[model samples]
Structures are given as structure tokens and as C-alpha cells.
Target chain A: EAGVVQSPRYKIIEKKQPVAFWCNPISGHNTLYWYRQNLGQGPELLIRYENEEAVDDSQLPKDRFSAERLKGVDSTLKIQPAELGDSAVYLCASSLDLGRNTEAFFGQGTRLTVV
Target chain B: SQQGEEDPQALSIQEGENATMNCSYKTSINNLQWYRQNSGRGLVHLILIRSNEREKHSGRLRVTLDTSKKSSSLLITASRAADTASYFCATDSNTPLVFGKGTRLSVIA
Candidate 1:
């Protein structure tokens, strides 16, 4: 089975511009997650979806960051008026379920560079 | 706040030697998982050890979890150059998995 798939392996945009990243979870996966990883740091959870509902998104910056998962299969994370600090690798992951034993598989994250 | 923290930010070892990385988390967790990521790529799941369990093994990788101490350790035996990557430990606590600042392992051939 294919792992989580993300589009635009790398993206470069100027500050104050809007940017969006896309993700397609693995088939039959019921849980999806978006995470941001900065240089020399671990990934921080941005949002999580259980099916079409965003069950957890407290860490998401509501002011400029928004995310949506339509039909519970694909997801999109958008950042409006991006800032230089917004540059990082956005990773999308999926798991069969939210069960404790399930393992999440990640995509080749979209690295964003805000100039 | 990040839940997990890995020790020895970086490690360098020769092939055929053993590599050990440690991780500690703050709160209770259902399970802990280890993942490896090559530079500029996504993370690959390596192993998952449930809370009730103390030890789990996969091929050359051995994971030990200590719920009492909220810590875990990963041991890679007979390492190879291909094993050079950043290894992260994630704690799943009913919410999304929270990762640690991974340990970068460099296996020299």
C-alpha cells in the first residue's frame, strides 16, 4: 500500500503571500495529522482529523493557518500572509485508526521557505 | 510544549557497532513509537512499544519502554551506513503523537 502522499515536495514564497500544502492519506486510514518541523527540531502537531471532522487543532494558529479535510481522504493546510518564521517542513501522516497500537505513516513533507 | 526529549543530540559510530538512543516523555501515554527520517524526507516508522509492554524487538532493533519512569530506549545492533538518520520517539497520549527532538546517528562504513 502506498504511504501518505503530499504535493509540492518543496515550496518557496515571499513573506505576506499565501501558501497552501496538500496531502492524500493512505487508503482506509481513518486518522490524519499535519505537523510542522523546523530545522534541527522535532515535528509539532498542527492539526488532526478523525474522518472529516477535525478532532484536535488547538495547536494550529487560527489567525493565519487553516486546514481542511474534505471527504476525510485528502487534506489541505493553508497559511495566509506567510511570515519568515513560517518556513518549515509540513508533514502529513495517516494511520489505520486512532488506536494505541496503530502506527502512523508520513509523507515526504512539503518544505516551505518564506523569503 | 513538546512531550518527548531525546538524549545525546548526535551520535557517531562505526558500522557493525551498536547504537543506542534514549527518549523521555512527560505524561502518561498509550504507546511509544520510534521513527527514522532521512535528511529532507518524511519519517518512517521503526517500532512501536505499548505502555503495558516492557520490551519489543524488530530485526536488529530493540525497544524498551519503562512506563514507571516515562522513558524509553532504542537499541540498534550491528548498524550500517544505511542506518544513518535522525531517530525520533513519539508518545501517543490519546491525542496526536508528540515527537522529540530526534537523535542524529551517523554510522560510518
Candidate 2:
């Protein structure tokens, strides 16, 4: 099977500009996740989706970040009015199920650079 | 705040040497997973050890999870330069996986 796929491997935008990243999870996977990784740091979970519904998004920056998985297969993460601090890698991952033991598959993240 | 913390911010070793990294978490976790990230790329899942599993071996990789100490260790024997990457430990909570600051390992051939 194909691995998870993401679009626009790299993105650059000015401060206050808007940017978006897309991800297509593995086939038949029921769980998707978006994460942010600052330079030299581990990824931080931004949101998680079980099917089309977001099961966890408490860490998402509500003021400018929004995500959706309308069809439960692909997901999009958006950042509006991007800030300098927003420069980081945006990663998307998926797992077969939301159970405690399933392994997640990741895509080659979108590296967002805000100037 | 992150639930897991990995030791040795960076490590460099010659190829064929054994590499070991440690991780400690704050809360109880259902399972612990290890991931590898190449430069300028996304993460790849390496291994997962449930809280109930004490040790597991896959090829040259060995993982040990100590629930009582809230810690885990990953050992790669006879490592090769291809194994150079950032290694991260993640905690599987009820929600998403909580990750720790990774250990950057460089294997010199």
C-alpha cells in the first residue's frame, strides 16, 4: 500500500499571510492527525480526527489555525495571518484505527516558513 | 508541555557501534512508540511497545519499556550510517500521540 501523502513539501509566506497544507492518509485508515514541529524539536499534536469528526483539537490555536477532514480520508490544515513563530514543519499522519496499539504512518511534512 | 522526554540531545558514533537512547514520560501511557525522521522529511514509525510488554526485538533494534519507572529505551545493534536520523519517542494517550524532544543520532561510517 502507498504511504500517507502530503502536498507542497515546502511553503513560504509573509507575516499575516495565509497558508494551507494538505494530507491524504493511507487507504482505509480511520484516524488522522496534524502536528507541528518547530526546528530541532519533536512534533506537537495540533488536532486528531476519527473519521470526519475531530476527536481532539484542544492544542490547536483557535485564533488562526483551523483543520478539517470533510470526507474522513483527506485532511487540510490552515493557518491564517501567519506569524514569524509559525515557521515550522506541519506533519500529517494516519493509523488504521484509533486503538492503543496501531502504528501511525506519516507523510513528508510541509515546511512552512513565515518571514 | 510534552509528556515524554528523550535523553542525549545529540549523539555521534562510528558505524557498527551500538546506539542506545532513553525516554521518560510523565503520565501513564497505553503504549510507547519510536519514530525516525530524516533531514527535511517527515517521521517514520519504527517500533511500538505496549505498557505490558517489557522488551521486544526487531532485526537489529531492541526496545524495552518499564512502566514502573515510566521510562523506555531503544537499542540499535551494529548500527549503520543509514540509521542516522532524529529519533523520537511518543506516548499513546486516549487522544493523539504526545511526542518528546527527539535525540539526533549521527552514525559515521
iRMS for all predictions? 1.1, 1.2
Residue B20, model 1, lDDT: 98
State the weakest 10-residue window (summed lDDT) of model 1 chain A.
A96-105
Q: For model 2, state the Cα shift of residue A57 in Å.
A: 0.4
lDDT of 2 by residue, B15-107 (tens): 999999999998889999999999998898899999889999989999999999999999999999999999999998765579999999999
Q: Summarize candidate 1's per-residue lDDT along A1-115 as a digit string, tens digits.
A: 7789999899999999999999999999989999999999999999999999999899999999999999989999999989999999999999988836888999999999999
Best by TM-score: 1
Model 2, range A64-103, lDDT digits (tens) per residue? 9999998898999999989999999999999988946988
Provide the lDDT at A93 for model 2.
Answer: 93
Q: Which stretches of candidate 1 lie over 4 Å from their true place?
A: none
Off by over 4 Å in 2: none
Recovered share of real interface contacts in candidate 1 = 0.85
RMSD, candidate 2, Å = 0.9
lDDT of 1 by residue, B1-109 (tens): 5899999899999999999999999999999999999999999999999999999999999999999999999999999999999999999996758999999999999
- Predict model 1's lDDT versus the native: 0.94
